[model samples]
Target: MLIKSEQQLLNFIKYSPIIIITLIAILINSLIYIQNEQNFEKDLEIYKKNYIESNKRLTKFQVEKAYKDIQRERENLEHRLENRLKTRVQEVYLTVENLHKKYSHLEEKELLNIIKESIRTIRFNDGRGYFYIAKKNGFSILHPITPEYENNDVSKLKDSFGNYLYKEIIDHFKTEEEYFGELKAVKPNMGNKKFEKVTYIKLYKPLDIIIGTGEYKEDFNNEIKNHIIREHIQNVRYGKNGYIFIFDYDGYQLAHVKKEYIGKQRIDLVDSNGFMITKEIIKQAKKEPGFISYIGSIMPETGKPAYKTTYIRGVDDWGWAIGSGFYNLDMLKYLEAKKKELRAMNNESLKKTLIISLILSAILIALAFYISNILKNFFTRYHERIENEIQENRKKDMVLYQQSKMASMGEMLGNIAHQWRQPLSSVSTIASGTKIQKELGMLDDKEFDKGMETIVKTTKHLSQTIDDFREFFNPNRVKKEVDTQVIYNKAIQLISSRLTSKEIELKSDIDSTVFVTYENELLQGLMNILNNAIDAFENKEIKNRIIKFDIKFQKECKMPNCDIKECSQGKEGYITITIQDNAGGIAKEHIDKIFEAYFTTKYKSQGTGIGLYMTYEIINKHLKGFINVENSEMKHDTQSYKGAKFTIILPINIEEG
Candidate 1:
């Protein structure tokens, strides 16, 4: 049966590696696959985000460029109208100049009459166009309106903008051959309100007269604006299916590719998705320039609605809403392409991971086989080697144990000697001095009494110290009749200096003659508890540090949820000893392990970690007692303090352990 058990153990050791390595290889590959799958999902989302953001930025740029162009075109329209007026005035001036030369022999006034009659019926600029004649001396040769100024001082005329109309004209002719400017005048069948007009005049030097024609500036502005909307705005294009569109605040389309919709109210027009696209554009344009989005016309490339993101700006001066937009393509094809690339990358990664896993498994398997063969060879000679080792260890262990015992004894003796050195030296000095004083007949009674008292106290302390140390290693264990109060006093005396030095206050309700048994062991445990409390206060910076000690007789301990069977140890009654302190508290994480050997919260130099362990052993093993520790809160003098409490429960009716 032993051989079979050994064989089974050997079999397990020899074959387990291959199985473990295979499992590890499978796990590695599985992890790689899962990680790749997650990465693909993340990459897909990132691609979609970047693609849409890029297109949005592109459309914004295009729309802004178109908006600037519209602004620039509006400025250019003014200059365009000015040039047209200059050209038309030159044509009329030349035509009149030719007639004046042909009829120079006729009266100058008759030639002026002929020029006016020939050009009177011709009209342009929305029928607000007409020709006029003026003499070189600022006299109206042919006044188109206000015939009262036909032969009088026309220089006194003022336009609606308060310009000295003929004065400016005569002033320009004095230095220049022609004049082109803006002024105001009434027109044929027009109201007496002087309408603002653009006038162009040229000096006809042959007759000492000025030939000019004028057009209403308001009418010219409207014509130029309409021409721009029809020609330039309608033709402007950017990205695929991108175009500039214009609409009035009333939602009438002014310039759009949908020619049927031009000049028609489009507020009711909706996209294929039934979204009122024109109404939304107009609404946003009313507030400020901003971007709006809706489903728009279908894309020719893909028969789906090309989503439109349009930027609308309100030209409040013109009472028009101008906008341009670019369409977004369907993403199905783009995502399909990205998916193929992702698959290719995942395939490559998986191949690499598998190859590396296989290589690692092969190497591990080879090592396993080699080690198993060595194990078999080692097992064949194991009995003889073990026999030799057993003999050698037996000799070595005996030597080491004896050495360790002697070393501990030596340490104990050394401590005793070190402690005794100073007091023994003092005693020797006092005794020798007294003998010398007596020999010299100089020993006084008072001095002699003081020396004797010191000698007696020091000797008693040394004797008590011996009893304490002896109990630590005494081989013979027996129950002795003891005074429990004396044991408690001894424990208190050991740590009294520590408590004093650390300024830790002690409160005791330890009634005398409590049933504390195993005097030496209990003394050691109690001293350990007190010493720990004192040490805890060494790092505290509080002024009212306190440690409370209490002992009592009861049926069971104050531990309401006591797990220990109190009656099993002593059926008569129970004795409980509790020590609590306000040195903050034992850390909750370290509280459970506080009594375990070699477990301490202190730095290496400060604690050996054996104090609590020895206390636990003494109470539980030697005294047949139960011990527990926990964090507790207490109120003293109307002040709250948090600390740790250690409770020890012992059998009141004693017996040998």
Candidate 2:
């Protein structure tokens, strides 16, 4: 009912599946792509963070390893310094031992002078090394670098650090034949500033004399420091452009790739943004050894200051800030490559998703068409079955119509005989009388003319009656204009004889309205109703047996389910015929079924049951009108009459069959 037609239904079935699936596919693919894009952004950010964090860790570890290498190399330098001092002190002690042995018979002063002179000229450690001899009572017997303090009772004398330097040295000699210790002394070549000196002393037991020589690191910066910086720290390299650089807190570049940078004050170094990179590195190094960002900083690739992430470390003992970094450009390169890979992967994923959606949509479309085809075939078969059934019913209706026509013909023939009986008798009687008169020679011309004229008139009346009956049963259907009252009177005329034989009174109420319709078919349908009512009166006892035909030009609706636009518009609507009988009302149960074919209450031979069915078929299917029956009460002169009322509504002017 919603689809209205087979083609519309089929079309809907055909296109709906693909349409629905296409929308769903679009929705699903869009969601997937959106979600993937969101995830891509989120994951890329995380990847950047993780990558930067890993590089920071790498830089930190590299700097820490370089720091450890520097520490190891400095320890080696210290060990070598200690070895040189010990070896030189041993040679000077052997010189003293030899001098004491060779001058054993000489005076102690002279022996001491000989030992001092021998050790004095035997300077090692770059001429900053020297020996001294003291008496057993802490008296300075001879001195080389500080000869002004010699030959004095220096028992209360102290070094720059307020220590009794000579007494402590003699006490050490008294206990052990040799000793090694630190004493506050001054380097003659470096002015009179006290410096921590490392000394080795030996006892000359033959003269009860103490001899000592010492070395300090006053010249370390010009020699050993440079060697360590050049060999160890500067030579340490990691990745490309990864070099260890050391600068003191005082801003001197201690170890560097550029020879000019080494041992140069570079604290005021700046980058593109005028940011003091070395100053910031130094600041971070002092607080805690960690990472720092250097925007507009230097890079190896560009050789210009750009962005970099650096790790800074402090070597507090060396007053140095150590820093190493990889450039931001390098990290960007790695991240950019990763981004390109992710983009390719995301595009491929999206492509696959779209392709999969397309494939699924295609499959759904195919499935939809497959199902539509199946339904189409089923509908076609169903349509064929229904068509076959409708055709069979139509054929059966035709058969019933023919049978009803035959029955009506029999009734019409009987009515013709009834009406013609008296006329035939009168004609026969007139002819017999005329014949007798002529035979007897007593019949006059007037009498003969009268008899002959009466016969002619009677026979003409009979012929006219037959013609009306013949027209009533005529099967040829054609549309024509006719008077409604005349048509109804003709229907009553055909069946009036049957009503008379049953002692039924016919009441006529006809409206002289005009109609355009099939004349004979309408007449036949009306005749069937009158005949059916006549038959219903059989064996019925009714005080005032009456059959009424109330026909009129109905302007209002009669049939409840009327489709005529004129009826709704309150125009000249329809011709309504209400045929009722007071013989008796039809049984309630059989009212609805009475119009069906072969439905009858009478004996099979007496009631063929097709009269009303034909009427229904003509009114509903053929004439495009409607008919219904109901048991109702009709009053005439205050007298109640209850019977079956058959109402028929026909369009006042029908344009279609």
The C-alpha stretches of model 2 lying farther than 4 A from their native spots are 1-14, 70-76, 94-116, 133-142, 149-154, 159-163, 202-211, 217-228, 295-297, 371-657
lDDT tens per residue, model 1, 458-534: 88877866776676556565566555566666666555655665777889786555463667677778877887887
lDDT of each: 0.77, 0.80
Candidate 2, residues 37-149: lDDT per residue as tens digits?
A: 89889888988899788878888997898778778877777777677666766776677778777888999777777777766666666678777778777778777777777
Residue 11 shift from truth in candidate 2, angstroms: 5.3
Clash pairs for candidate 1: none
- What's each prediction's TM-score? 0.52, 0.51
Cα lDDT for residue 514, model 1? 49
Off by over 4 Å in 1: 1-17, 93-111, 114-130, 136-138, 142-181, 184-196, 201-211, 214-219, 236-240, 271-275, 297-307, 326-329, 336-344, 355-657
Least accurate 10 contiguous residues by lDDT in model 2: 563-572
Pick the TM-score winner: 1
Residue 82 in model 1: shift from native, Å?
2.2
How far does residue 518 in candidate 2 sit from its true spot (Å)?
73
